[model samples]
Target: MKILTTPDIPIATLFQNMREVYATCNVDVSWASEEVLNLPALNIVDVGTCILGSTTAEQNQLFTHRNSAGSNDIVIYFVEATDPPFNGCASHPLGMPGAVVVRTATQWTFAHEQGHVLGLNHVNDNDRLMTGNGTANITNPPPDLVASECNTMQASPITVNV
Candidate 1:
């Protein structure tokens, strides 16, 4: 879904970046729909709040309140600002199901948020996607995932259905 002031982001390019960001992971990355070459893909706008603060009327309460976000369906909400410290976030309240918020829609942002959707958490490794406050730089490598993380991600109910 499109958030206020984010229709101008380059979704196709950024999405590709996300795919590359998770290349090392066991999960596959594909557009939810066709490739959006336009500056603003979807025009429908709504409340696009960061994962850490969902108190606003627009943020998804189900995720923010339950203490579980980005554990379910990948809802990529494009907002207009980078006020939030994180580039993206998992949106699910139960089991990490939720939408991914992309202010800049960078490749790292997409992949980092997806990491959360896959039930992965942050780490101290700067070289990994799970690094605390994952980087948006394209030069960085993909997020790191061990056999266990891959197993957990692959076995998740959401991934299985996909």
Candidate 2:
């Protein structure tokens, strides 16, 4: 994790929530390391609505800070904010598995964006983790991840057996 800005919710709280969510699906997730960045120029990134098909120069620059991360490792960048209407983004430069999260994100936002990094797409269900409407709209507490989504996540190169 690379924190460009402090999030409204504590990172520990968010990670706890994520661990609980993924635990239900038998996928153990944990952060290997963290760093606090002082790049004021890249703090507030313009993601242009976070379309998964492309990336912005600002995002490209921001993501370059991944230090010594293996190709299969996923780097999570916590920024002050994305353009607007997006709390987090899963799009990355080709072959780089990464995601950018905003300071205002909900507890589940980190998990949702990481889900995308693991090849999961948005689903219409509000009770699920992959909801297209946003994490705030999730109707269920500790949003559910169905079997198929679990398979996709586990199959990703970023996932490894213990």
Candidate 3:
């Protein structure tokens, strides 16, 4: 999966955290600036990022196809939640095909959001990256498990045209 991050600082850091997790799985992932989410390398998992307060209604309006785009492309918006939901959530009120908003600027929050993009539901096991209740110590898991478990979770990526 490939993630497209805007020029936001915290959002870029969140992408870095995802790279770390991908490394743990021994999975190769490549991301570009807000400009490139369609490179051939990124077959599945296209995510976009924007900062809190910086994103305007105009920007959100551009992605109107998300509601029923049919493509698996999901945009992840980094917003400051009035109160961070301890549990994981999708950015839009309608839920599916929208970005995942995180209240904090922490790396764990990004990882948690990425977990949603990867098709893993909230797992109660704290050791698992998908464990969605608050922050779990899942920054890095064993590399083999990352690749193996992640593949097991999503056999075919619904996103990405490849």
List model 1 lDDT by residue over 1-162, tens digit each.
Answer: 333344344667667766664555546765543222223322222334544334333344323332222344455555443334445555444443445454555556656666666667777767666677556542346545666677767776777444
lDDT of each: 0.52, 0.88, 0.44
**Each prediction's number of clashing residue pairs:** 19, 0, 1
The local distance difference test score of model 1 is 0.52
lDDT of 2 by residue, 2-98 (tens): 9899899999998899899999879998678899999999888888768786999988888888886777778989998777548999999877789
**Highest lDDT, which number?**
2
Mark the regions of model 1 whose C-alpha exceeds 4 Å error after superposition: 1-4, 7-9, 21-23, 34-56, 61-72, 82-85, 93-96, 137-139
lDDT of 1 at 29: 65
**Candidate 3 residue lDDT tens string, 72-106:** 44555433332223322433322334454433335
- What are the C-alpha RMSDs, in order, of all predicted structures? 6.6, 1.2, 9.6
In candidate 2, position 19 carries an lDDT of 91
Better by lDDT, candidate 3 or 2: 2
TM-score of 2: 0.95
lDDT value, residue 143 of candidate 3: 16
Candidate 1 local lDDT, residue 40 = 39
| Model 1 worst lDDT run, 10 consecutive residues | 35-44
